[model samples]
Target: MSTPANTITENPPPISTGVTPQRLSTLRRWNIGLTILHLGQAAAMLILANNFAIPVLSAYTAGRPGTIGLTTSNLFDLRIGWAIALFLGLAGLDHFLTASFGRRIYERDLTHGINRFRWLEYSISATIMVIVISMYWGIVTINALIAIAGANVAMILFGWLQEKMNPPGRTITTMLPFWFGALVGLTPWIAMAVNISLLKDENLPASLYIILIVQGVFFFCFGLNQWLQYRQVGPWRNYAFGEKTYLVLSLAAKSLLAWQIFAVSLFS
Candidate 1:
């Protein structure tokens, strides 16, 4: 007797719906544009921080007992603009490589390879985090450490949940490094501001003012663009924080931080 057809079972092969070369080229263009923008902003900030802000503050309180210098020479003895540019350039390259590799794996239907890459990404990021924290140990204050740790923990947990619940796309793999690098790129500025504030000198207020203006503008623009892009491409966009909420919250945070900094500049 012939076996019933219903008793047989079959599983379909995984589909290979990889990203095309044209799409990759487009993404590369976008990434390059972002890199340029980041570099330009960093250059402007360096000019403001080193040339304009420092000289003005120094001149204003030249002989004051509690006044201190705000120049790059005094603060870190490092070129802030070049550092930012280098970090951003590396970040852009990381994003591009990750995206390209992911696309190739998808095209080849290499599930195991994709998982391996994910682990490697996490490992590299964690290593970099350790190195950064160690490098800035004395410079980074307790409050800044707490803030950064908290933000990173939240991001990590959220990413884990995302991977479990919905997995990730090629786009996310690319964007993750860029976002992390952007956050890291802000560290130097943040550290300097904190140092100046803690010094409790006459120039502290002016230093804070410059940081507020520069950071406020940077975060506002970057956060807005990220929010918009997240709306367009985020995996959980439909379920979690919708596009409007994301954009509104990001902008609101930027404004609130700006106001706080302004208040510190005025009253501190």
Candidate 2:
């Protein structure tokens, strides 16, 4: 029965609105329905393991099913496809698990929260990309793979050194090694772009060129995001996001790129 003016003696806040957070919680609480949706997506991906059952199943992967697919055809393509499927399925499981028991994960594994998506995350992403590329390239490009391995090792070291140098305060320490690794990683894409531009012997679908360029640009975006986050620079200083938001975004972008590149390998 008491109003804001009647209750307060000094600096009273605004009057009541539509619904407070406590009232909203009662109306929109997490329950079994969200859990089921998450699990259903995970289950649906099983269709990806078998390409022959339904031609439409390939739609989940958004990939072509010509001559080979899933675990049914060429050894190289199979391995590549298998990795992509594994990543997608595991990602679905992650969402389900997070939804069902995100609090525990938040308290335990995700303690660092948003700060976790820094150099360490970039290192892990770079390692995963290298592994996938190495598997696809195989023995034919052993020397080239070795060079890539060396570059990745240097990349990790740089990331580590940069993290160590980073102090508690959000001072602008523009870690050069991070940029160095980013530039180094672009070599393969640049080579691919150049070869295609010159009409070389390499055979691949035209759409793949678009994918590759987009993927390269995506990597650059990641680096820029990291730089912005590190410095809290410019317009980025005001932006805010929770730990889970960054986790899902980082996973989705990196996984989607991996999936697409792996799918394109089948064309080669």
Candidate 3:
């Protein structure tokens, strides 16, 4: 029996059959890009931190052979470098954990229990960063980071807890709170980036200023991407909040925090 024309017109074929080539390409690109960010950030941290050790240690040993020692001027880096390295290692671990999220999402395995635990892990990382920051500068903005980190803890524990039950279906327990935290965290970086962008030749050499501007652009782009991910655009448009988007956003936000929190310990 032939179907009626009106019925056939109303119920057209499904738009997608399976994962298309374009989607596979996008996934590959995302994986590559995230890996670059992970490794690049780690390398940058090591190089920048080691800047203090190289010349200062050489000078301290008065050009002795195979010398490795610290001096008064570079002591700040000594105090904080290890902590920064430790933090970077944790961040690197996040990259690996997040990489698995894509598969989990596809499997429809993203759960409220897992999300709450994820938030818990983030809270711990943020707390460690705060403690590390204290060893360098007692800046008031560090207090804001503290608040943000603490808020994540609260959101995971109080606001998100279904309490004594394995909740049904997929859910991001801490998505909205994390969005707010990310925005609030952007405050100091935005101000710094804009301020640095306005520096003149006398303030900093042209090349250095240009690098700073580039960093600013990176920060801005991260924020914009974050807004999209938060809204579940493109690859993120799954179950309101999906593992892939949150995973990438977490990496970006954590990288941003590392950039800001250790700015003085690093560059100075």
**Best to worst by lDDT, what's the order?**
3, 2, 1
lDDT value, residue 125 of candidate 3? 57
In model 1, where do residues sit more than 4 Å from their true spots? 1-25, 35-82, 98-102, 105-157, 167-199, 205-207, 210-268
- Model 1: which residue pairs collide? none
Instruction: Give the alpha-carbon lDDT of every model.
Output: 0.39, 0.45, 0.46
Looking at candidate 2, what is the lDDT of residue 39?
Answer: 40
Give the per-residue lDDT digits (tens) of candidate 3, residues 80-158.
Answer: 5555555556655554454455544432223222344344554565445544432222222334334545543453343
Candidate 2 displacement at residue 58 in angstroms: 32
Alpha-carbon deviation at 1 in model 2, angstroms: 47
Model 3 earns a TM-score of 0.42
Q: In candidate 3, list every pair of residues with a backbone clash.
A: none
Per TM-score, the best of the predicted structures is 2
Model 2 C-alpha lDDT per residue in residues 1-268, reported as the tens digit of each score: 6677657566533221222334223212332333344345334434443331101111122356563433322222234444444444444444444445553442232222122223443454454455454443332233444565566656656655554455333336667867776667666555444545666546546655556555556656655665665665664442232222334454545555554664554333
The worst-scoring run of ten residues by lDDT in candidate 3 lies at 52-61
Q: For all the candidates, what are their Cα RMSDs to the real structure?
A: 12.2, 13.4, 13.3
Q: How well is each residue in 1-268 modelled by candidate 1, as lDDT tens digits?
A: 8889789767654321233355445544544454454345435434433321111011223566777852222323323233333333343344445346554543232221122332333333432332232222234333444455455444434333333333324334334543564565455446645655566456333544544455446444544444443445454333222322332333343334333432442223
How many clashes in each structure?
A: 0, 0, 0
